[model samples]
Target: MNRKNLTHKAGRDNAEPVGGGGRIRPVNNPREATKTRPAGGKDAKSTGIDRTRNFCIIAHIDHGKSTLADRLLDLTDAVPERERMEQILDSMDIERERGITIKAQAVRLVYRREENGDGGEAEYMLNLIDTPGHVDFSYEVSRAIAACEGALLVVDASQGIQAQTLANLYLAMEQDLEIIPVLNKIDLPVADVEAVTEELVELLGVDESEILKISAKTGQGVPEVLDAVVDRVPAPESAVEQTRGLVFDSHYDAYRGVISLVRLFDGELAKGDRVQAMGSEEEFEVLEVGCYSPKPTALPKLGVGEVGYIIAGLKDIEALRVGDTVTKVEDPAESVLPGYAKVLPTVYSGIYPTVGDDFERLRDALQKLQLNDASLFFEPENSRMGFGFRCGFLGLLHMEIIQERLEREFDLDLIASSPSVKYEVVLQGGETVEVTNPSDLPEVFEEIREPMVRATVICPKEYVGQVMGLCHEKRGVSVGMEYISTKRVQLTYDLPLGEIITDFFDALKSRTRGYASYDYDPKGYVASDLVKVEILVSGDPVDALSFIVHRDKAYYRGRAMVEKLKELIPRQQFEVPVQASIGKRIIARETVRAYRKDVIAKCYGGDITRKKKLLEQQKAGKKRMKQVGNVEIPQEAFLAAIRI
Candidate 1:
């Protein structure tokens, strides 16, 4: 399987039909131009559920999941040669620009098994799901895995196993999915195939022979991997009881409305059928249904064990939530599918429009974005930055994606406040409340408890001391440590989620020279000596600029904050005193000198009395202006200073 012979550089040649499970017909056009199949062509499958295979690719960030998916598509001839593009599944501009999969994309591939001394060749339908490799999108990965019966555990041959690789594998194991170990990038110059093979065997407890080696870049050994998927991974089990489909992912289309990526568990979904969402109890007529032929190709119906999409003309994105079950309206299933746990937002921030009048537009954009993103949570908020939405996200990357989408897709100029973690505050009145916005925090509290995360960092043994020191400086407690391999050590710590949400990951990457991988799970809230550090601009306390910090780091944080604010806030008519305080006590202060001019310059060479009188008048004017003039902080200044 050489890359040179795969397809033309300009893609002018028409793709040849592949001989597989079913007849592979050439569409010779984009998905939009392809016509719908006949009445029973999709639903009338001669094969049973035992012949179908559904699985996803799981790996660490940049471990080549998308590339491997491209090779599989090529092997199965799922995508046409003329229109084949790099990262076909990662359709979003942001996803391609960042070189990361933000959403899980599903595509159906047909593989024809060569008959061993038999008259006819048998074909198998392989529904391969491509998932994101970043920890921020782990929830998306989980939902995709739920729709699969097995997974291809991909590991980088050069980097060996990483934190997220193991994390994703554990998730698949939790779902009881059959696992197939694969070593990718075998063609790279620095690839150590044998060493990575041993690591996979030790970490996954799989036999060494089970590991398949391939170079997703050159399409080497990809067919063997596909064959292994058909041989090793078991087929999906059928349920004859009733109609049930798991809504793993979805997106909006202006013409078609909401198109949900679903996996049919029991019966079938067809066009013109009435379907109901078990969670929201919303019902709509199925406008269309089909599998992704690299695009939405309309089908008559999707049968059991099949993975495809359903369009129900849903205008309200909130009507169909991810992880909800969709069943027939008249004869619905008695119980819902074992849906996944809802993903909660771990980081919080304020998203405001720079121009005050764009508030409603921002609100509308967020509402539309939230239609596809289930983990994003938001509500209306009033602050110094004007009326905006206080939104929550999975992590820093997730926050960044939402911000970028709002700006790019909606053409919005947004002000994103610094990311903060949820804090548990216990008031003197015996009320415990979880606060995401620092401005929403009450004045008096009996105790302030901050969320903690159990973080696991895997790195080379030589960097253990540096990693441990970094964690300790962040106020982390060493929970556990062990050697994953002779040169690799896994270190676990309990640290404040606030600390982890900051520069911890970047620092870890730097200290380990990009060899360290890290992951964390929330460990709930713990009592801490924490207090709100307020920032006062020109003798006025700005609630939006306040932040909660541990008492031990209070002075350092307050000083750093005041210094940053000094650099950000411009000089006013009067000397604006920037102060950081805990309650009424000011801990740090900085000043922005007033812009002054020579008001007495024109009175030169005049009488001494005249000059003195002019000076007196100028001083009086200055005093009066200082008493009445208000400090006007620029939008940029607010964006810079309030992030602290």
Candidate 2:
């Protein structure tokens, strides 16, 4: 259909018929329809399986995945003009402000195709999943890819391909999903469409003509993208006969309980039906069934090959997981579907509420957030800072986003410990244990193994030397290097994950002038001379300030920590010494001078004997105070030490 003629009029009767005589009835007011829609009666007819297309958009950060989604919605008239906005699918405030997609979002669009000479016009159902581009949220992309049959591989025409582009491409290829190459941001003044097309041709092994060049910002050639999806992408195929659906995503609703977004593989699910989560083995009566046309619109039932949401009044947050399988309780599937692999957090930290009384509130907030973010892992623990939770995150960005959400959404002030990686400790008894917190490290260990990752750095050839220098400083070992194009190069190295988790990305960006793109995969652990450095204030070791570092660099890191602590700790009535030690050996030390009370000031003109007597008495009092006085460490000191 022509782009100009693709508009959907609200409340219009006798709408055009889709394939198999299904009508394309567009709901003008979704909120009203949701409230008035009946349960299990006069349900909307399902479009034929042959006319349904399920696909997701995958790209590097800021490569315009969300922009392209907006254009598609505009072309299909899926969103009302008054309510339309840029990055509409990014529902979170943090996402819109940062211009990134943290969570994967799914929306259903209805498109009407033009009639050919021999065939009549037909309406097609397009299900589009917009996925995040950052490496930390790659798990979300993987789950989205599993639910779709095709992916739109978006590339920036001016920047060509990037590290994440290859990473996401490999993910889609693993699922054997059909990939449609598209070059975005072609309207830029310096956009080298030909060069990028050549890069795409070499990487995808597709002809130059196969790549679609369009400017998502201006809505140029967006309608053609929809046509390509309908013509090139295949329909979903279900092998199972019994009812089965994949719960690709879910979130906790305070009013409705846990609402799950699922892709139906076989059979149908209707409101009031009893469904069971294969993973949790929990059954609940379905309270509602609907689809997201940018907004929740209630439907009577969801059919095979259809994507929609299910509200079963699941009060237990753990009852429905993101990668679980949902099936009818009465006629359940013989077996559970192949769910996604469990993602383990790579970075660890201690998240403690600023107010100790908010511990339960923090726990409740985390439980609700975990319901939405399956990758977040946490457990209760006690440290010198009092009761807190040791949380695990995918990466530093993921950690920042979660902490930010907790503060904004739950109104809780929190302090996060320095990010650390899991380490393997082998004891003298020939036993090994995992250590995520430095304070948990044993007093004596035979050896320590630190986690490592295989990192990929893509940049211009001129900056290759700077990138390599930065990597080498982080203890990286070069694996290989090659030229992806005449002007761009790709560098591969193996570096410790602990090193990359702290300031590595920022250093790389500064060294490359923000032209480098980085991605990494875990390569397990390797034996290293690791030592746990303990920070002591006034002869007392602060467990919260301890950290693990390589033996060779322990002295320098310890010195830096003590120096920073000296500047942060407040002056006390008695001398306070800050020291960094490894076991019994002291590596670094700094002192915060005590506040002196001039006893001699009162006897300025007195005899020498009287001044001496006053001085002796003052010295004796100071010694006594030093013996019994307690030094209070401020919160700023802890934050500074962790950052250092």
Candidate 3:
């Protein structure tokens, strides 16, 4: 295929009709195609695996992976011209509005090669997977990489390589996949193509000529990217004659049940075949098979080396887990494929619904979302805030996205507690327990081990000092530093995940004027002098507002928490004291003064005894109220306290 021959028109005016007329036709029910079809069809398995190429587009956030994917779809005619739009694979409104890829999307494209001297043109099947670029969603990238043979390493020409770009590149290398370096956004006025090309050459150890410079936004040099995939990336090796497929991803559908996105490695999977999950050992009959032309277009079967979905009438999302293998029940593989390692959550928070009745609804929403996002973990929990779920996430952004999705998709009101990292607490008796919630901490513990992370920050050389200073304020230990280029530097640091989960990234960007890019990996746990600071409203501790902080920071953090609570809590009939304390010792306190009524206003001309009597009576009533009355903490107070 050539770029010059491709049309950039927006509508169907440039589109050719298939077997039917130009009129659109409704798709039949997918489950109706259960009968096995005859062999030797146009399927890729029959055509030979050499004509197929599986690859994924990986890059940092907002680096044009989605834009490049749009151009590829246009060039290959995989999408109808009328249906074309920017970031077509990003279906979620949050994703489109945020200008970031949250979930990884997969699509199958067909490209025809130019005619050779033999007077024959070859057609190739290109299975392209578009992955998220955020550090939190890197799990999606890893799953996408596992199902591909090559990766399009997209780098911004103006900004050059970034923290996530290197992170994703390492992931692709770990998979031993072929890397096709691509410099995107080259048409921008500020693009330093020569400088970025030098960086790529030095980092990838490839000739400068090997790097392809393309403006994905303008469709320049994009066809060559597809060509590289066809020429350089190898096809899937031949597999033994056994049916096996990997469920890289899955989601729930209201009408069709669970749709498992799978990549076939061995033998074909046809509709009506009995399949069992190798991990769960649960069996189910395949209801349908299909590929995503960005949509679920039904096919007779999914052949080897193909990326597609399978409908098995699975109603329970857990029945078909991501990273689980599916094999035929009659003839299963000798052993399951090496599936992905379990991803542990790095940050934990309490997710509660404002309305108590919506607890069940929240659980249902989380379950369906978990099917789509395997990284989300949640369990039932109860506290003074009422019934809620303690949810675990990959990072703060991941937690925010899930909360937004639940509210938008499920139409439920939710309140998220302060984010915390998992900590290992050793009891005085030498028993260790993991605590994800501050309220879950035992009364007495010998030592607390908090999870740590190694963070990488890349920025211009001018901001190196500012970046290091910010990290130091967050209790970060400097690991090392290196100059990627004469003008740019990369700094590495070891910091507690607790610090990163808060406003650390925001602070870093503020310090570097939004010029620094950051990424981090878990580095296990280390013992630290940590104490749980509890917040009290009128002498009663509020479990939701309690948090763990280093002993050195407890006083300052407690002071901040109480001060913020003072401003947020509404004035009451009785004086409400907002106090932050460690154990039985109060560290900080703020008072919301009682709303006094001028009982003596009507007795302005009365004697001194009358005024004093009224004042004393009013004081006694307030004292009585203070003894029996409970302080009502508003929802906004909890929200504001967590941010503090």
Best by TM-score: 3
Tens digit of per-residue lDDT, candidate 2, span 194-220: 888888877777777778999999999
Full candidate order by TM-score, most accurate first: 3, 2, 1
The alpha-carbon deviation from the true structure for residue 119 of candidate 1, after best TM-score superposition, in angstroms, is 8.0
Can you write out model 3's per-residue Cα lDDT over 255-311, one digit (the tens) per residue?
999999998877789999999999888999999999999888999888777889999
- What value does the lDDT take at residue 336 in candidate 2? 74
Where's the lowest-lDDT run of ten residues in candidate 2?
Answer: 18-27
Model 1 regions more than 4 Å off = 1-48, 117-120, 600-644
Scored against the true structure, residue 312 in model 3 reaches a CA lDDT of: 89
lDDT of 1 by residue, 189-214 (tens): 99988877877766665667778999
Q: What TM value does model 3 have?
A: 0.90
Q: How well does each candidate superpose onto the true structure, as a TM-score?
A: 0.88, 0.89, 0.90
Stretches of candidate 2 exceeding 4 Å from the true structure: 1-47, 117-121, 593-604, 607-642
Of 2 and 3, the candidate ranking higher by TM-score: 3
What overall lDDT, based on C-alpha atoms, would model 1 receive against the true structure? 0.79
